[model samples]
Target: MEESSALPRISAVDLFCGAGGLTHGLVRSGITVRAGIDVDPACRYPYEANNSAEFIEKDVNELSAADLRPHFPDGDISLLAGCAPCQPFSTYSRAGRSKKRGLDWQLVNSFGGLIRDLQPTLVTMENVPQLADHPVFQEFLSTLAGYAVTWSIVECSKLGIPQTRRRLVLLASKLGHEGLAMPEALGSRRTVRQTIAKLPPLEAGQQYAADPLHIASSLSETNLRRIRASKPGGTWRDWDPELLAECHRKATGTTYPSVYGRMEWDAPAPTMTTQCFGYGNGRFGHPEQDRAISLREAAMIQTFPRRYKFVKNGDPVRFNTLGRLIGNAVPVRLGEVIGKTLIAHVSASRGATGAGSGNAQNTLF
Candidate 1:
């Protein structure tokens, strides 16, 4: 690690970089993301191709300090960002068992392990807000002994995300300065209308030719019929009694009518989930389109750039794969906010010590 006096070059090594959402945001914030690590091979093409960052198809637990050091050779001001698989913490999971199933909670501990081993200048993590109250989170925070830590449960809409998603973000730095707070909201929240209404109309399961971003996921015939009966922001109650599922006739099913509903044009979208492309799943219907939101629409609400490419020519585009990637991503806008906060902390530390050496061109929106 070189010890030049210049404001340290901010470089990041992203862990569990699903489809490069956080990496994209970090790049937008002017931070150089040298590499991204994820276990899913499906992430390899998009993560590397879209972000111009090296993609390592490896599990976080298999990563060694030696493997990561190469990406941060200078080690001036390195960032370790991880948003581990969230199935264990997700409210949508049907498994009532412990987090040991395919969705292991221990993965979050691995992130903590990496932070301890690398001792990077900064660390950031994003996950479902419920994680903030989890025991693992408490342990991870307690482990950051010398570092200043600041965190918040932020509503995605407040940060200009077009979905009503909430996530827990934690930022920490080894410098004595307190961790930086998230940026204030830019303006009033963006609604579904503001985000996607301008796009050309498409029937259920249709794709637009002019804009690849206008692609919509197809629906099953039954689901299509169900969607037609569904109202924006309304529930299964709006359906004909004959259309209701046996489960819906039960008290428990009736309690959660928001499922299989439509988004209100004027309101933020429901939280994007791994199943968001399925019209039968959650409130994923387009306000007026009578179909599930498209892959492009889901990406947009997740704060991805409209033109961000997800696949190369001729590559298969499966809804399950893309939906999982979009739902599991750290919204790019939120990533920018985190990146800017880190830059400010690092720059302020360098300035106070009169050791500024690197150019301060990094901008956080």
Candidate 2:
């Protein structure tokens, strides 16, 4: 197929950008991200290093319209995109606490506040699906009085993400009445084996020789023994009686088989979490390898391009930091789908009238 002409010159500011996954996808789909803001300083190096965008290390709450005014000065099709921290709405959060406080939830509301104040032409937010039911979500929708809003709980795999993750996506526009819908499911879901089966074999705690990004975390001797007993697509029940954890001996542990489990090569992988690099975290083990998935593998499964850089030379490689960046990001492919949908909507709107209607298309895939 012949390459299309240069994409539209629209600019965007990504809030709460974790290592630029969504930004990367938007760029690939032809949107120019001018700057990215996140509280985590670690995000600065990787995000700025990888994308053609500036990175701001500042808390969203501390920001005001003036701080963002320069980025959207043209008032043309300026876009605001964010994926706030989802711990507050996560099912994994501990249930029933007397003191109900969530800074993350506040941060999302602040994101809404930014939208209300900045009044960007296009706005998009992605979060864990449960957020769709939160009262705060309703308030967020209400806050966008002039903008047309559309949202959905979408399966990431349906958008070609190669994992079973799901998220709630909201897109609102200031120009006309339209809503953004999920993109059409791509071909058969990409499988775990299809994603990483071809990499050179490495031992349980080994890093690849040629590629630094191909490094895998080391496994403890006890974990190594446990991995040896683990079976692909099987649970701890497959292990010898002596190898079982004390927790597993209890009734509650029986249902947690997805943990310390190997992936099935033929199926899509389980949702990649912040601790996915650890062997005992979840079903993060390699399909056939005796090790948990590597950082590169995790990024790839998160739909980051193989060439995407995550660290600078001489920087310490911290598993927690890297994992959080990978797990918390909007999958690059999903961002592309959102980007394309927005582009098509803008194009159609611009064609219908000489004005750029900021509305998003509502055609569900």
Candidate 3:
């Protein structure tokens, strides 16, 4: 086996990089991310400020290989990585909808198109697990004709992330590596208490002066009372008849019991969604505090550093904007796993002929 110092140097570019979560992880695993590309101008500050990578603010569809080649340094192993938007493939999306519709699929095809044009030595992608069953994923797979490919549904908690997110991860190598795999599960699962119990407490409508992102959204008078009565890991069924919403009073409403609930301190948090800051959102209430989780807490659950800055100084912290960025981000811990796996795969394939010489799965935890 080759030593750590013997591993090939890798340079990468991130597509659809929101606030630089995946880039940050890859950097931690010793990959040089030259740039991140996205359409949202709002992502530029945090992406460049934290990741030390250039932020190209443009739609991915319009970008060509000529526009990207300059970023990759000569003689380095080239890597192309990103998480294209996956909301249309989400379980919450309309069921049984035709796979042939929407701009989301178009964005995914744009990614495949880049791979065809550039032919990077390595590639990685992350998205919702449901993407595995969609036709769009098969279409994306067809683009890698000469590459060896492997993919799986990765559980975030098993990777030491504090959230219960399951993602579809894909790895492909054009360098003749076989059976390239995702990283093995770590020692233990992280819990909500271990992740966020030490932050200063806040009321429903309060903001912490020390950390602006610690601000919680305001609750209505009835919501305040409802939260007070809510028990850890318990549902709104614990509420009194008068406190129940009109939806909850209906027979069909009982089906969605996870809404308006408190998180269990010992358990992993439910997946963070775009509306994660709202009290009425699914299982978002703090276990002890009488409010929803703050933006900092949400980012932390996604394995982002607490000091990760989403906005500039003097800029007002808006709940909707920050929530979307945090929720849509790839968990940084999972990204590290991808980076480690790729490093091991590339190292193991160095002397082999169209077959892997070692098991990369059990190598790193």
Candidate 4:
């Protein structure tokens, strides 16, 4: 480690970068996020608008190292950052989810190929903790043994995100570093109330006229009674017998109690999923409101800024489209921690090198 050598500045390209969640965090940490690449056309507007990074709409499987090289310089501390879409491993989608012909199953391999070809200075990936046991994840790891790598299953609540999501975060460097420093925990967890208390409230299935994105899906009459019976953090077991779903009334349905429940105002919300805007989806119902958590609230829980516009100028905000983009994003706080860790690691390495050089020169004299 030579003190005379300057630390390399980081530049990154985010693959599977839906709505620029990771990019925003990297940018905030002062990394030059060159671009965000995703296959979803719905992601372009928000990714471009909220972050200074370019949005590249393309399938990562189809991307070549040649396609990615032009975005980064010939030589620098370039980072290939990605959070490959994680639906196949998701518990919610497990009912009928199959790996056969699923595009997501192929992405980890594609990510490996890109790394093999580009050989970027560093790599970082985040995904469901379940990925560690999957063969695709093992294959991805096999490609990185030449580099210093470390990964852990992290509790998102510890990282200041207002949700109880867990993820597998991995970092690797070819620059003589072996692993990343884990992000420190906040003094206290942020709650759903802390994240969305100030936003204007909305009625069921109503849009806040002033801010269209601050909207909630409507509840059916039966759902209305069910929600009314729902105590904060309580499940359908608390509902009146008349309102219980047929499945719930059966002996077999006792284990699925988190559905049709309400989030507690003082606790972190449950993981935001693609259908989080629906009343019957998981525990998405609002703590105090008579409706499900709105899109804006859901985004805020994911730690997206309040003003992040998910829709284009004339586009309508559809649940499935925006929900997928939002739910699939890496939490911005986690990204910031990752970005800052890289910076600190590079800086420390430079300082250590500089001190070694001074000692060597003294020895020579």
Candidate 5:
């Protein structure tokens, strides 16, 4: 192989780069992200607008090593981040396994195939913790035969993301140094108040004029009443018996207490889901507001900047689309932590200095 002629710097390609969350964090942490590839065209605008990286709309399964080589340039240290969509392996996915699950599981193999073919200097992957137990994960691991690998189930709250999400994080190095370790957890957990309290509040179904994404969904009369009765961090059990949904009154429904709940201002939020804007979805209702959290608030909990653009100037803000883009994104803070870990490992291996301070600050909207 010919030696790269460019100056030494970490350059990365993000797979499944929903709205550029991982790319933004990598850029923030001093890594040069060359491109973000995802099948969703909805991601292109935000991915390019926010990170200043090329957005390639292509399915990962259809991409070849040659298709990616042009993006890495000649001499930059190449890093590949493959954060496949995790819904197939997520606990939130349908209870029983099916052909659809089998199909999505192959995405992990496609990611592994890219690593095998490209053999980049560094590799990282993030997914739901449940994936670690699946055979697909073991098959993916087999692809890193020559690299030193380390993986752990990381708590997002410990990493300063104000959500109670746990994920599997893996780092692999082919540079003959120790595999990169996960960053140390922060001194304290961030809370809902700390992350989104300063934003302008909105009533149910109201939109903030200055920022379109700050709008909350309209609630039905019953849900409006349900949210009114909810206490911060409390479940449907706190609701007046008359206001209870039939499901909530049933034995099986009791298993789903977190639904129709309000997030506690003093605590981190529950995981944001694709349906997070709906008042009845998970514990997404605002602490004091009698409605589900706004799109902007949900993005902030996922660690996206308050002003992070989702919809374009004239486009409509479809709740389902925006919610999936934000909720499914790897938290920006978690991505930064992963980027810093890779930078440290590369710096150690090459006996060279790492880029920037790695203490990435949030950009204003």
Candidate 6:
């Protein structure tokens, strides 16, 4: 029976599963990701192709526990993972606003309600660090008081991801006084040069012939000249007087000097946003190339595997659509850490139960 019986596993569903970044990482750590739910139809190809999970192209607000139950298996620990769109909570988006709330905000509430209804054995969520400040977040925390909740703010670069992003990672379990711990960091920081140095070089607006996605966005003649003058780790202040944008002369624009800057080769990249493919957005210019980083390069910085196909063959690689997908994704390496942490918790719980029963051999990790 030991040979024939299935090993205990945690079955998971990824909510708002953009391009399956988190799902891919968790799957790598031995979790059975049963399905991914998102309203974006564009995510279907990558999410389904990269993992053995069904893709549900529907609004999360319309889903219920009954609808989700069929996706998981009959006998196993049930888990739910979600990272709702974090735009409203982002510092960049809320720069001048007094208040912000929208449909995406409601999605967070819906996620909490689903958890309350399903009462899964484990739950995990990742989002912008700013999320913890909002009233909605406080409401969400109230829902978790019944469970053992552990959350922390982490820098992605410390976790072996090349981009410099700060995020909130939360893990909750109903299995008695569990705490989520930060995964051990790489002894040294993972730098941009260490991540994307060896790929064949390409000019602005050029694509690698072997890979359709390894293409950079086109730069205008004026911006092209401007990029040439910009030094790595330098801002618009490095530019010639003639190449400066009109706003840069103003005090308000001086506050946003990181714009039109190049990334430092020896350091982790600035946080990639939806416009990471554009030269004027943030500090997205390539360290040496006179162009913004390519779509493939951005995904790699997000710690996705090199050959993780995002689109089908013969499809045109559209920049805007893909930029949204890659920028909003959780780093795959972080997801793998969460999976391993949860797995260890399950093992520890089983070991404690076995000790109580005086059957030391009953636990298996």
Model 4 scores worst on lDDT over the 10 consecutive residues at: 356-365
Better of 1 and 5 by TM-score: 5
Task: For candidate 6, write residues 1-365 as lDDT tens digits.
Answer: 33432236688999988899999888877788899988777889999888989999777787898888887777778899988775666544421111233465787888888888888888999988988888878878777767888888988888778888988988898886443565657557888898888777888999998988899999899999999999999999988899988899888988998888899999999987767888898888889989988988888888888898988999989888888788777888778777777776776765532111121211222
lDDT of 1 by residue, 1-365 (tens): 95644556688999988888899888777678989988777788779778878998887776777788888857457899988765666755422222232536667888888788888888898887888778888888876777888888888788778888888888888875643778657678889998878778888868777555467777777777898988899998999988888889988897787888999999999998878877777898989987888888988888888877887766667777778788788888888777777876776766643222233233434
CA shift of 160, model 5, Å: 0.9
Against the reference, the lDDT scores of all candidates come to: 0.79, 0.78, 0.84, 0.81, 0.83, 0.80
**TM-score for all models, in order of appearance:** 0.89, 0.89, 0.91, 0.90, 0.92, 0.90
* Least accurate 10 contiguous residues by lDDT in model 6: 354-363
Cα deviation at 232, candidate 1, in Å, is 1.6
**Highest-scoring model, TM-score:** 5
Tens digits of per-residue lDDT for model 2, 1-365 = 95534334568899988799999888777677889988777788879888888999877877887788798646458899988775755544322210232466787788889988988888889888888778888888877989888888888887778899988888887656442455657667888888888777887667775655677788888788888888888888999998888889999998888888988898889998878888888998888778999988999999888778888876667777788788777898888777766776666655432212332222223
Which candidate, 5 or 6, has the higher lDDT?
5
Instruction: Flag the better candidate by lDDT, 1 or 6.
Output: 6
- Residue 265: error of model 3 in Å? 0.7
| lDDT string, candidate 3, 1-365, tens digits | 75434555788999988888999888777678899998777788889878878999888888898898998888888999988886655534321122332477887898999999999999999988888899999999999999999998988899999989988999999876644898658869999999999999999989999899998999999999999999999999999989999999899999989899999999999998878898798999999999999988999999898898888987999887788778778888787788877776776777422212122223244
**In candidate 6, which residue pairs get closer than 3 Å at backbone N, Cα or C atoms, i.e. clash?**
none
Higher-ranked by TM-score: 2 or 5? 5
Query: Which residue pairs collide in model 5, if any?
Result: none
- Residue 136 local lDDT, model 1: 84
Model 4 CA lDDT for position 84 = 78
Q: What is the C-alpha RMSD of each candidate to the true structure, in Å?
A: 3.9, 5.1, 4.8, 6.4, 4.1, 5.2
**Model 1 pairs whose backbones collide:** 6-357, 6-358, 7-357, 7-358
